[model samples]
Target: MGSINYDDSDVLDVLIVGAGISGINAAYRLHDELPDKKYLILENREQLGGTWDLFKYPGIRSDSDLHTFGYAFKEWTGADIAGGAEILAYLKKVAEDNGIAERIRYKSKVEAADWSTEERCWFVTVNQDGEQKNYRARFLYTCTGYYDYNKVLHAEIPGIKNFKGKVVHPQFWDLKEDDYRGKRVAVIGSGATAITLIPSMANVTKDITLVQRSPTYILSLEKYDPIAKVIRAILPKRMAAFVIRQKNIARIYASFHIFRTFPGVAKAILGRLTKSQLPSDIPLDPHFKPNYNPWDQRLCICPDGDFYTTLREGKAHIATGHIDQVTSNEIILKNGERIPCDIIVTATGLKLSVGGHIKTTVDKKTVDPSERFVWKGSMIEGLPNYALSIGYTNASWTLGSDCTAQYVVRLIKHMDKYHKSSVVPKPSNRDQLTQRPLLDLNSTYVKKAEKDLPKAATSGPWRMRTNYWYDLVQAKYGGYDDLVFA
Candidate 1:
């Protein structure tokens, strides 16, 4: 941020914020589709991989398979589940292959963005290190993700200060294994993070305990696909990957449909599968039971039953209860029980953050994000020249992000055709639409911040659906039907 100045005549066409998966995908599409327009990605971190680079824990892997989580442009030929480091490497490869590495301004965090109705542009203020800088762009795409990366979210337990052990959170893992090996540990969550950490460190640690308030659904698939191997050997790499990807995409769609439409059937089948991986002495129902239906929260994917296999081997234990307090040597439960441990892994979840907490102003008046309507789950209502890369909740994050990029490209083309500088979707029939929660999930993270989140119209083209096929049709063939561009 050293005196970086731009000429008034040379304002960027777009300022893509965050160098993570969504930002990178947007950049690729913008570069490919609108070559003449100038654009730059402003990243808060020094690295390409946002979540992958940020979390450096022992067993950090993708909750979803790599095939769909991967960009539509690239094919992931690796195992079904991908490690964090491997995912980072893949992101770097994408940046290098696309020649977008040089276009990224690392360590640049956007603090605020001011939109001028008269100028039809945005004045973005960013902080790089201690230096502050300004950038102007016609459109701002915030791909900063939906969670707070800097601060880990956890409940303040009674006597947490008294715990005389290594207290750790998965978000701030030190990337060191020596500290946890041969130590008794308790992971305080049953989500993807806890599932991942327990499996990766269970064998090395003396004993591991998964302390959960409630259970979540976990599914298992083969880490190495034998069918993929045969297909890859028979056809070209990309072609084989494409065929396998389509098959897997269909499978994912069908699985989500089954989980949502026939929750009881899904629950019974999942319970049976989970029970098969545990010892007969253990009761799988109460320990692994969830009150909500499947897909209410994300269903975690265990690579080749790694989590279940480790649990069955007596290397791990499950403790389901309320945290009464934290003692010097153990965790006191509400039921007068104690879990003694040498280390406590938080695995608690991330705080939801949108727009990077960047203050947004339109014509000097502050824009309350909650008041904005998420049009088509990308553009916000009344906030002109601004768009966000929101992804599918039921499918891979990239599936929606990739389509959103394509949709934005179409929007930009429409703007050009109309010779308009700003475009924001306004409800054609606002009275007819029922505003609902932006995220329809039972996950703790989503629930905590759902009120502060934007609203989506219930019955309109602007409404959001978790189905990838519906989104695909909406994003590809649908455009500007319910929007008013100015």
Candidate 2:
């Protein structure tokens, strides 16, 4: 064991965990709003960009448009749907341009954070380069997002171990080593990853089959927005970006409202659009038609109808059935159909996690997040000077996270103005509040991690809203009288 190093000489004004999009947004806000405050970003990985850096599979692109997903401080003058490498480069440029890159410490994984009432600070334990170190901070911010990075959701398939071919998960894909040229590939799952992989690998592989247990609502969107291009040509760069961003945001809000309010109409429109793109031989009934209404689960997006184009080109096929077993050379379906495959790619899903699985405690008493309630969709109840940067389920992730960053900065400013040392959300009638799931989605991953997540409420600040417009307004001018500040 290495010697534990404690740095008691310096205490950060704010300590942010995870150096991804959320963390980078938070850092920029702090730097711009509170320049005097000391802060640092601790990233567990060797690089930044969080999800963009983690996923290296082929045809990996943003589901949301870059104008809305990109930070408000910067203008994304590229295509709406950008690849993982392009997004990562954008993030790196943001960090470098704003001096955030210097504040980031790579390979620093937060293990535990304990708040001490006596010291009025959080004692954080971290492992850096295989050595344990300790640091103190006046405020703690968790921007780790809501999913597990080290683990992926396991799909159960009988005789998986008996298969002799290569089994790959998108989360752990290595493009350099995994060769698919002229090889028959079968990708399991109908989510975004599978939709992306089939289109991307169709040209290189001999034949690609998309195997799904159930269909998900998928829509085709233009890769480049013509309206955005016209706006950029007419207006100044910053003005154009702002206008385009607002336009995209309104479109997202309107589409979601329509889907939830008029499910039948939305379903019919989606069905018609899908049917038009797909070949006549491939029936829309079994393969494309999803049982659940749109937005019940997240809607998958394929830029420029790439997935459908691949299917129409005879390079890809769709198999909608439950997996019965896996043989050495093929996948056997419960319907007695066997699909030959040289490589099986499991694009199943991610495993949900809260606060990046960091152990949290207050004066040695363990803090179970499931028991606590979220306050203003940013801070957790009964937690001192702590804030969570989570995004919206129905819109671009950065919009909600940016709202959180603004709210946190406001809270910090309020604390500084009143000469307060700490602030915590302490609802008087905590036990009587009705509990709701923090994430409003009904997806498999969200449902599986419900018991491990924090609780929301039916009303007041304890309730969490997925509306980006409402959240933006609240973050800017919401009152904090319900909070306990000292």
Candidate 3:
């Protein structure tokens, strides 16, 4: 940890926390919109790129296409739909290119932030290099993504500690050469992490056993878009962004509409595809089949049918069952069967919490986030001089976050116009509203954090729709106008 002394005379207009995708974008937009307003971005890590830099597993790439994952203002020029390292570098370059790096205080972790009702400012306490310091800001902005920042873990298997094989979580993958080549590997979970790792590890390892409690429905798309290339050649990069975004959104929407409204049609198409890929005897249970529809819970994308292709080639094996226990060198399935493996990759998934383990307090009183209402998923009820950049659970995260940023800039302009120092969300009936997790969909992160999250007011504006077009209209036109700042 590092520390810096703040001069009391200089009160920051805004304090941005976290240096990840959301934070960087917020800072970049803030400086671009309000160059005269003093703002400081504080990050706990020595480096930026929160999750991308943190996870160093092999074959770590964006689950979504790079076009939507990358910032709206910037273009992703490199290859492979943006892998973890590439994305990390891209974020770093964004900071360096815009001169925002100088404004970032590395290794400065915000220990506490107290809001003052009388003064209408936030008393921020942060630790740096083992030293604690204090500062004050008129507004506070947090972009620290939802997840446990340190050591990601499984839900604690009965005898996990007794396992003798090399047990590793994708979150803490060691980059050094701890060879898994020629070794039997077992990958747990059917999420993006497990699915991606299973097929890829098959080539390196002797064999890979994909252990899944349930099956994940996967869709394939071209890694690089021919149309995107053509558009990039003809139009400016930003213009291409708008066109491509619309095209992708439409494609996803059409696919999902069929899956939801016409289940028979969706099943027929998926059934044929599954039959072509797998043996007829293999069961495709509709129980594990998603209830709502595709794109309801994120539609997992696989380019070139990589996972399917590898499975058919006899390199990888999929095992769907409950693991009874971990043996010294193998896993015991619930059906009195044992599967042996030399290495275990628990892609069991990440724990989700807002702001990455950040604890937020107002006026020195511990605030339950659930008590506040989320207005447009950016402003929290009863909290003044603060804003959050919350991404979409169903759609592209950057798309939604960027949309929120656009709204944030508008809100800032509105505040400036009125010479207002603070803006808070005031709900008509806070207790009467039906509150639920922002996203009730059964993904790992959603399930983890849904219980304690803040809700929307009156369920209409607060009711989050994962639909891109719906959010686009709300963000760009409808819902933003209704928000009262005064």
Candidate 4:
């Protein structure tokens, strides 16, 4: 309801960039665990809930179960799988309930962050409205997410730019101005956004073209928000929260493990499910098959065969062929077949942001922020009293992020008792060699920042466990004590 005005010259305990899930969680943890500490969160958007607020595409929902995706301190009382708006509302409540709203500076975009070795703090530069301001803090955390603030619009082959139709990217959906009613809309990409948007848009649009470069593994989810409703009725707030988290965590880990240990088994089961849901003619082959294992890039979810049913009824059509180009009135496939559409929706993918894009300079020399290796995906090797809150790739992000926040809180508390100025992640040589992407294989983000990323050790807990169970084991009780601090 109110706000806090701070002078640019003042220094704070922690300065967090990006008010997304990670940044919000970090601020909440800091406020609750160390109430006396000073902190602030800089958000570029007017609202909180970074991704949730940014994406307004139709039929948006969570791919990960809300149970594990939710904050550890707050219970998810809604149905099992929450929609985007519902999730956004829940996040807003989390901030409001914890009095975190006052600490967030809306519309303030951070330009850069420089580490001052002499001052033992970070100098944060932010652009609020039209004014540039500066803030100093002892610690910095980035949660801007991987997407580079750009809508993913792939080239639609030859003559795409000439197309007279309105082209849109899901990341930059405009609900008010863009009208889909009675228009033939072609939604590209087979990922979650395209799958979800296609089914819903079919109801209003004249027809829908579901285009894709390759086929992705599609699965059905529980359509209704059962978890939220059940918790609201029967359980106390705290207990309901705990049960939801535990249940979701168990289910995710169990499923992830089964898929990882037996890829063939997962493929076989999922294959049957897919065939039974869609038409038999739709080829599910090397085109749809991922070069890596399942759960590698995230499986797309369509609750209760909504997407399949939409296609079956003829409101939507799935185009598996490659695109050759876009003309003024139609999309031409590599096979030379042209399909006419009034609007085009591209849901290609998202950019991954690590450490919220904080720029760090040491000794007046710019350290390519992407060059430093990440320690346990949280702390950078050479940075003191700094932590990155990246989450699990397979499981819900909140599961990993919340755990990381708690660990950081505890670590901070431990340091305070000894009057320590910093707590750095000093990994052994073996540990450094073993660190790998939680999910192996070349991802755009991992490959782009590999040189700056910590070399994952091949052995020990630090070796990089893509499995949820292994990560839980390590984050909970294994090898953490070995991280040295001075």
The most accurate candidate by lDDT is 2
1-486, model 3: which lDDT tens digit per residue?
A: 122344534788888888989888887777677667677788888989888888878778888777777877787765525578889999999998877777788888888788887888998888976899887898888888767787574565656677887888898886343478889888887788876787667787888888876666776667788888888899987787778767776765677677768877776676566657664444556313544455445666677678778877788877777789987888887877677888888888777656444556777777677667787777777677777778876656777677666667667777789887777777665566787667646776567666667775436566655676666576556644335554
RMSD values, in order shown: 2.8, 3.5, 3.6, 3.3
| TM-scores, one per candidate | 0.96, 0.97, 0.91, 0.89
Superposed by TM-score, candidate 3 places the C-alpha of residue 474 at a distance from the truth, in angstroms, of 4.3
Tell me the tens digit of each residue's lDDT in model 4 across 192-246: 7888898878888888888777777888877655665586469877887777677
lDDT of each: 0.84, 0.89, 0.74, 0.73
Lowest-scoring 10 consecutive residues by lDDT in candidate 2? 1-10
Error of 4 at 235 (Å): 5.4
Put down candidate 2 lDDT per residue, 1-486, tens digits, no spaces: 112232433798999999999999999999888887888889999999999999888998888999999999999989899899999999999998887888888899999999999999999999987999887999999999888999998768788887888899998997543489989899999898999989989988998999988898889989999899899999999999999999999999899999999999999999999999998889998898998889888899999999999999999999998899999999999999899998999888888876888899999889988889999888888889999988888999899899999999998999889999999998888778898899888877688888988888988888887788888888989899569999
Instruction: Order the candidates by TM-score, highest first.
Output: 2, 1, 3, 4
TM-score top scorer:
2
Of candidates 3 and 1, the better by TM-score: 1
Model 4, residue 480: C-alpha shift (Å) = 5.6
Please give the lDDT score at residue 418 for candidate 1.
86
TM-score (C-alpha) between model 3 and the true structure:
0.91
Query: Model 1 segments beyond 4 Å from truth?
Result: 1-9
Per-residue lDDT over 160-197 for candidate 1, one digit per residue giving the tens place of the 0 to 100 score: 79999989888888746788889899999889999999
The all-Cα superposition gives candidate 4 an RMSD in Å to the true structure of 3.3
